[model samples]
Target: LNLVDLRLTGTIPPALGKLSQLRRLALHINALSGTLPPELSGLSQLEYINIYDNKISGTIPSELGALSQLKELGLDHNALSGSVPKELNKLNKLQLSACELGGT
Candidate 1:
């Protein structure tokens, strides 16, 4: 399914990463928390992922690099900490702010 405009609440379900056919996942402006599920690395076809304006915490998942096709990623205004995953350097367009980005 070509679902757009996604608004997820609570912890991000690991099941979402199983949607191999998913191309664009937009989960902005929600109350999502907890560490980013490593399972998300399974979405091989994912091109866009926006998880801005949420309470999500923890370091950015390095597994996200598995999305070879991912173009844009938004993780602003969250409780996320730790250094930006070096893997994220491959992303062409990413928006992350107001979070610590240099630590163990």
Candidate 2:
């Protein structure tokens, strides 16, 4: 499926984590807010995930690093607070914004 430019609210459903064949997930510019479900890590085939400009608040889940194939992760301008997931260091392609992380 070709899904883009979707404005979804509430926590990201754990069900979405089941898309084993998903390649890209873009849900930017929305009111979606909550901790990222570790279940999302199941999407091993994901290459991109755009959930920027939202109300989502919580520590960046270390599980995100499981997207070994991920090329881009957009999570800027949100209420999220916490140390940047150290696991993220494993990603070869990451473009996180300042607002999502900072020195304590």
Candidate 3:
């Protein structure tokens, strides 16, 4: 599912985790806020997640590391804090530039 630059607002719905077959998720350049729901780990087939340049905050969920198929994760330009979860090293591409990661 792609909803890039749609001017979307509010938080990303946790119910979206039910989309078991979803492969890619792009919701970048919007007004989306709130923490990423760990429920998203249920997307076993997910490969990429691009939610960049938004108002999202909080730490990257360790649960996301469970996505063994995930290759790219674009979450830059947000208000995220804390160090990246070590469990995410398996990803081939992880983008978190411009995030408030406390020098980690």
Candidate 4:
């Protein structure tokens, strides 16, 4: 589901992980807060996840590395903290942003 640029509010529901067939999820440019749901790692078929330009905080889940099919992960301009998970390096095709987790 592509929910980008919707100016959405609130946090991402962990229940979304139930979408086992999901290929792309874009929640960028919204007012959503809270950490990325580690449950999202359940999306084995996910190819892209764009949640940039939001108010979300917390660290990127290392479980996301389970997405062998993931190609891009955009988490820029958020309040996220911590270093990028080395497990993410396993994504050979991943195009990540703001994973450095410097001062927020």
lDDT tens digits by residue: candidate 3, 11-80: 9999999998999999999999999999999999999999999999999999999999999999999999
lDDT of 2 by residue, 40-61 (tens): 8999899888887878787788
lDDT of candidate 4 at residue 47, scale 0 to 100? 91
TM-score: model 4 vs. ground truth: 0.88
Worst 10 residues of 2 by lDDT: 1-10
Give the winner by lDDT: 1 or 3: 3
Instruction: Arrange candidates, best lDDT first.
Output: 3, 4, 1, 2
Worst 10-residue lDDT window for candidate 3 reads 95-104
Which 10 successive residues of model 4 have the least lDDT summed?
Answer: 95-104
In model 4, what is the error at residue 4, expressed in angstroms? 1.5
Instruction: Put the candidates in TM-score order, highest first.
Output: 3, 4, 1, 2
Taking all chains together, the TM-score of candidate 2 against the true structure is 0.84
Cα lDDT of candidate 3 equals: 0.95
After aligning candidate 2 to the native by TM-score, how far in Å is the CA of 94 from where it should be? Answer: 2.9
Off by over 4 Å in 1: 1-8
Backbone collision tally, model 3: 0
Q: In candidate 4, which residue pairs get closer than 3 Å at backbone N, Cα or C atoms, i.e. clash?
A: none
What total of clashing residue pairs does each candidate reach?
0, 0, 0, 0
Q: State model 2's lDDT.
A: 0.78
Task: Please provide, for model 4 over 8-97, each residue's C-alpha lDDT reduced to its tens digit, 9 standing for 90 to 100.
Answer: 999999999999999999898889998899999999899988888899898889899888889788788888888788778765454335
